[model samples]
Target: MRSLAFTAMLLAAPTAAQTAPEAQRPIAASKIVLVGDSTTAVIGGWGPSFCAYHVTSFAACVNLARGGRSSGSYRAEGSWDLALAEMRTPGYKNVWVLIQFGHNDQPGKPGRSTDLATEFPANMARYVDEVRAAGAKPVLLTPLTRRMFKDGKLQNDLEPWAAAIRKVAVEKKVPLLDLNVESSAAVQAMGEAAADRFAQLPPGSAPIGPTATTEIEVRPMAQPKLSFDRTHLGIEGANYFAAMVTRELAAAVPEMRPLLVR
Candidate 1:
């Protein structure tokens, strides 16, 4: 079994843009806040990729996400407070908050998972209300898929949470990014063998090193196979997922369309 390590320090610097649209109208500087657990956080999640590389130069991103946190615990851990502060900050009048959670919100974890009946959607709904109250648009994203392959097929454990997010987004009439479905479909299309490149390799083994056998040569374009770990995405994986999100956001929120490249 592979255990995903979440030990990366935040990289605040932006990276060179990749595959930007041919031309785009300028967008004024605006804050795009992210509120979520590690999966969508800045350090180890896809937020940095989406912020630093995917989006155009028009928007500023503030990702206030932590590892091992759920909707309930994230707020309890003071992460929510930090996001609220950002919402109140000046120059963010057109700000948008993207909320993604659920991996740590499952029942097994204590203080992490919320009671679905009372806390799950309620927590998410509160976030929507707060974001609006703070004068920012709130967009809720379904949890990204874990990319688990079972019986020769990819499986997703985020069904319940995804549904909850959808329900809340509908109730609040906020934008929704169905990353769960989009990511799962992308991974599934990559196929099993090709997808392993995204997986964490064994100790002392190079990610792009020679295969165990002399007959096999690691190819750069080959889809990096991701591991069995349910959470956390490697750099390549994170960028791939971020692209999906960026594309969706650009399409879903026409106002943000200028902030992204097709």
Candidate 2:
């Protein structure tokens, strides 16, 4: 009887050790990961404010966007790899990745741009697969419209890229946020002069040296008129875009409706 009892005790020890951690393990809920470049990155872009002020308490928000990164480069720089790792980690069973790229995908910069024919959609498709493989959903966002205007019309450079995302969304049956279209319309409605307020600049009190300080220029409603960088919003600008994101997500995801701030 004593020998038999000792063996049972040893078996029970392993069960207790395993069961304790299982019982204490915290449950992981749904989460969203935003992947893109500087335009979508937290802080410098609108993504930070979007995650901070827009979404409700129900979902976890993670923005993995980096400055000056294109879709090709984001993956190449291993940012996507880091994002993939995060998705597979414990408590991310209901993960969703939102991908937005393009500004840098144009054929000017080295290592940043892609051919757009095979390279663009191919990268997007690969991202979809990797996200799904990690047991998460992938949502494609058309690049946001740059606030460039010509003759009272919003000039869209990202049209093809946006179209590509839409195409991928249709093919993969994934959710999409047409930020490109929505933002274009939004900026056009605001017009050239009003839109300039969105761009960033150094504070007025900063000293301006003769060398011509890029940081210390008076930010006019359109002062740097030579360049129409009037579209990229500052913190407030990101908040606006973030609101649009919430609205679109609420409509498409519906289940996400309760998680958005009405």
- lDDT values, one for every candidate: 0.79, 0.78
Q: What is the C-alpha RMSD of each candidate to the true structure, in Å?
A: 18.8, 9.7
Give the Cα-based TM-score of candidate 2 against the true structure: 0.78
Per-residue lDDT tens digits for candidate 1, residues 1-262, read: 1232322322433444543556775545788898888788754578878888867666778878887899999898788988998888885438899999888988899768788767899999999999989898999999988767887788787888899899999999999999988888887888756555554453245345323545457544434333345456667767888888998898778899877755
Score residue 20 of candidate 2 by CA lDDT: 75
Q: Pick the candidate with the highest TM-score.
A: 2
Candidate 1, residue 166: how far the Cα is off, in Å: 0.6
TM-scores for every predicted model: 0.77, 0.78
